[model samples]
Target: MSFGAHRPMSVLTWLATPVLFTASVLGLIGLGGMLLDADWRVALSSALFGPAAAVTVLLAGFVEWRTVRCRWCLGLGYPAVVFVAGLLLGDVTLSSPVALALGIPALTVLGVLMRRERNRVIPIA
Candidate 1:
């Protein structure tokens, strides 16, 4: 969508993206960690409110608007990349691959919603 076609997003909507994204990632990690008998709390909490999460959301938003030019990257692509990166970094395992698999589609849908709403210009009454 073009800038001219874009409407300003509410603060709640803006914040909700990261909040929901972070929550999904953490929930998956927690669930997987439990299944794997790993330390899910530390893994979940640390990543949830941590700087990394914030940075990730901001970076994804910027990248979506600038470079990627698509919400799929932020929603799906980012998680996929994160998943692969985690695997390469030994952060993900067969038992606990939540961020990559589950997070991708969830975030992708969210990104689509965010994109659609952001691009719509409501007629002034």
Candidate 2:
């Protein structure tokens, strides 16, 4: 009756993490740029991208949440906190595609780590 014990994630779910993480990172970059210049038009345009990013991150989180029993969502959480910190500090242009590129590999590594750490977390069946 424990959480994440009833079902584990598929290999495809693990593989999708990088893709989801990358999309979210890109969306955050767009969001950051829009917030920086006080351009309402840009802000509006970028704001529209936020939900998709949030959803992608959330799906990645859900995969870990339901299978690994570790808060992979927190992986998504750190960048969000940093982004908010940047926005609040008026460092909007700090966004970088390179940083986003790094996130894809990081999430891939995380996925592999999770799979290695707990076989139960990954549904081979």
Candidate 3:
């Protein structure tokens, strides 16, 4: 949960999920609002928050690497969990079920490979 001061990561390992999760939700809201023409402010939020989701996720994944028991969960699942939460909270136009149905396996495989590649490159201590 704690990344000691020496490591110099922007977020704590535990906070990554929540930060990404919130960013996803807020980004969705901004995007939805922009598309709906609900408010001009949403445009800014969309620009700021949307990329934050990706950046935060990648930052957490590569820079602040942490291991999870399930590779499927590690690769595809974390994003899925936060994204689903985003959809629900932001009330985005995209259908969570439909997106997830198609995305799950592909992303899981990607995640697994990512771990495998890291294993080969980094090796376990």
Per-model CA lDDT versus the true structure: 0.52, 0.46, 0.44
- TM accuracy, model 1: 0.37
Give lDDT tens digits, candidate 2, residues 1-125: 45655444444554444445444455455456544743332122233334434544555543535334344545466436534533453422333444345445655666675666466544466
Clashes of each: 0, 0, 0
Best by TM-score: 1
Off by over 4 Å in 3: 1-52, 63-72, 91-125
Model 3 error, position 69 (Å): 4.8
Full-model lDDT, candidate 1? 0.52
* TM, every model: 0.37, 0.29, 0.31
Lowest lDDT 10-residue stretch of candidate 3: 5-14
C-alpha root-mean-square deviation, candidate 3: 13.4
Residue clash pairs of candidate 2:
none
